[model samples]
Target: MYAIIGATGHIGNRVTDILLNKGEKVRVIGRDAARLQQYVNRGAVPAVGDLKDTAFLTTAFQGATAVFAMIPPSYTASTFRAYQDVVGISIATAILDVGVTHVVNLSSQGAELPRGTGPIVGLHDQEERLDVLRGVNVLHLRPTYFMENLLANVPVIHDYGYAGSAVRGDIKFAMIATADIAERVAAHLLARDFSGSSHEDLLGQRDLSLQEAFTIIGRRIGISDLVYRQIPYDEFEQALLGTGMSRDVCRLFVEMSEALNRGLFAVNRPRNAATTTPTSIEQFAEVFAEVYRGAQHRHAA
Candidate 1:
């Protein structure tokens, strides 16, 4: 049996679906029992509890062959790094205690760096903590910027008629669909081909500029004049702060964007066919249009 953390989330949900379809026994873990009910109905065993509780996680992870681990973001934490440490330690300790033979962790592209990568620094710490587990094979799946992140700009597009971010819209970087990440995770968990602690980079089909991505989205949504704008870092930070995000989180987000704009995300690691996934910006735009239209319809109602 495979235990999946954050099973109600985008990547975890897809992983659960793929595994269950193949007749694999899946135990879906999440904080909300209601969120996990659908997976329960779909043949997955629901294991609902707070991830920060080691006892809860240890019990949930017991009797599982492999566990899919990820630290869900806590944007409102008073100290984000400390929160990540607590959760990471809990997961690592539980995996060791349960003697789970394999683990697949959802990490990010810049997780190799020890510092200066903002929120990614937490993921780096998680990787280091998990590395200390004896006899457990861990695979850190480091995926690039998620295309779904662009959905955060939906309100900006609706209100200001443009998509905006602190990073330059002209800079090209890998943007992956969450479904692709799930597919790879399912493949790795099912195959169990990897042993020892290792990492893999999941870049999308190709590098794409934000302007190029927005153009595709615009065409799909039938908004001929829609554009992508590069917001100033201070303005972006303030905007996030106004949205009730913690000050540290706001600063970290801007720093991450700055790092992206400076080409820090892809530094030293060149993309190849193995890293490139199949999903394209054009294909993701169709999904974006559906969401956009749904939001529009809700507003109209």
Candidate 2:
């Protein structure tokens, strides 16, 4: 049996679906009862409880062979560090208590960086806690910036004929679709093999510049005027704050963008079969283009 924490989320949902399709007995853990029920209806054993609840995780982890673990997002916290510290401790301790044989942790690139590396520092701490486990085989799956992140910019691009971010418009960086991450993770889970504590750097396809990405989107969407604009970090923070995000959360995002600017998210590992995803940006756009078009339609409506 496989247990997936944060199962209602985007990547988590894809992982659950893939596992179920493979005829695996899957258990899903989620905070929302209604969302958990949706997974239950899909043939997964639904466990409704907060991931911070050790008793809950302990129960969910029981009878599970391997588990997919992810730290749930906490955007409203006054201090994301404090929340990460507390939640990281809870998750690590709970996973250890459950005695699962293998754990596939969803981690970010540059997580190996030590303290004072800003956003990567928090991920480093999570890995530190997981590293102490002697019995469980833990694999840290570090994926680059997700392509789904571009979906958020669709609104700005459609409405204003451009996409904006604090990132350098011309800086080429590695980016992967979330489904590709799910594929790599699901393959690792199904293999049921343990190589002790290891790290898998998932570099999806080649590096792409935001400016180049805009050109591709423009060609497909028939909007040659589409542009990718570089914004100031302070302006980005203010925009996030305006969205009701906590200052600390906004700061982490800004620092992460700075880290990206430093090329901290690039992968150096040799590409392998596992890292190869069949989907490309063109394919993704072809399928999900309606979402962007729908956004445009909604604005016109």
Candidate 3:
């Protein structure tokens, strides 16, 4: 049996579907039973409860051969690291209690550094916490910038005619599609071949800058010249706060952006076929275009 935490999430949902389609028994874990109903219809056992509760997670992890784990994102936590520890610690403790032997942890690239990487620091600590388990085999997926992240900028581009973020416009980073991440994850969970604690870098097809990314998106959305602007650090933080993010989380995001600008998120291994995945920004532009049109329709409505 496979246990998937955050089962309705981007990566987790895909992993669940892949396993279920292959006739594997899956226990889908999430906070909302309603959101997990679709998976339940497909024969997954629903384990609905708070990720912050160790007892709840211990129950969820019991009877599973392997587990896919992650700490869901939080925008309003007053103290971001504290919130991470609440969830991360619970996951670790439950794994210890239940003796689930295989775990696939969703982490970020800059997690190599213990600090200065904002939310990624939490992932760094979570990796260590999971690694200490005596009998568990852990695989930490350190993926690069997600293409789905640019979905957040669609409204801005639709309203203001330009795409922007805290990232430096010229700095290139590997951009991945969540589907590709899920594909890698499903393969590992199905094969169960990896032993001991280790990690793999999923750095999409290649590196791309925000400028290049916006240009591809522009073509798909029918814009001739879509510029990607680098928002000033203070302005970006203020905008995030205005969107109801907590001051602590906003500060962590700013620190991560600064770290990205300095090229701090580095890969220890050389790029090769094993580390690379198939999705490209050009293909992802189709998804972006669809979202942009929906945004336009919403404004008109």
Error of 1 at 114 (Å): 0.8
Per-prediction TM-score to the true structure, in the order listed: 0.98, 0.94, 0.98
When sorted by lDDT, best at the front, the candidate numbers are 1, 3, 2
User: Which candidate model has the greater lDDT, 1 or 2?
Assistant: 1
Q: In model 3, which runs have C-alpha deviations exceeding 4 angstroms?
A: 266-269
Instruction: Provide the overall lDDT of each model, using Cα atoms, as 2-decimal numbers.
Output: 0.92, 0.81, 0.91
Highest lDDT model number: 1
Of the pair 2 and 3, which is ahead by lDDT?
A: 3
- Of candidate 2, the 10-residue stretch with the lowest lDDT total is 267-276
Higher-ranked by TM-score: 1 or 2: 1
Residues 1-301, candidate 2: write the lDDT tens digits. Answer: 9999888787999999999988889999888888778768778998888776788888988999889988877889898888888778878887788788799988887898875345667788888889888787899988877878777787777667888888888888777888888887888889966567888887777677888877787777778777889889999999889878999998888888887887766634456776555667776666447778888788899
How far in Å is the alpha carbon of 214 misplaced in model 3? 0.3
Q: What does candidate 3's lDDT look like per residue over 215-289, in tens digits?
A: 989989999799999999999999889889999999999999899888888423368899899989999999999
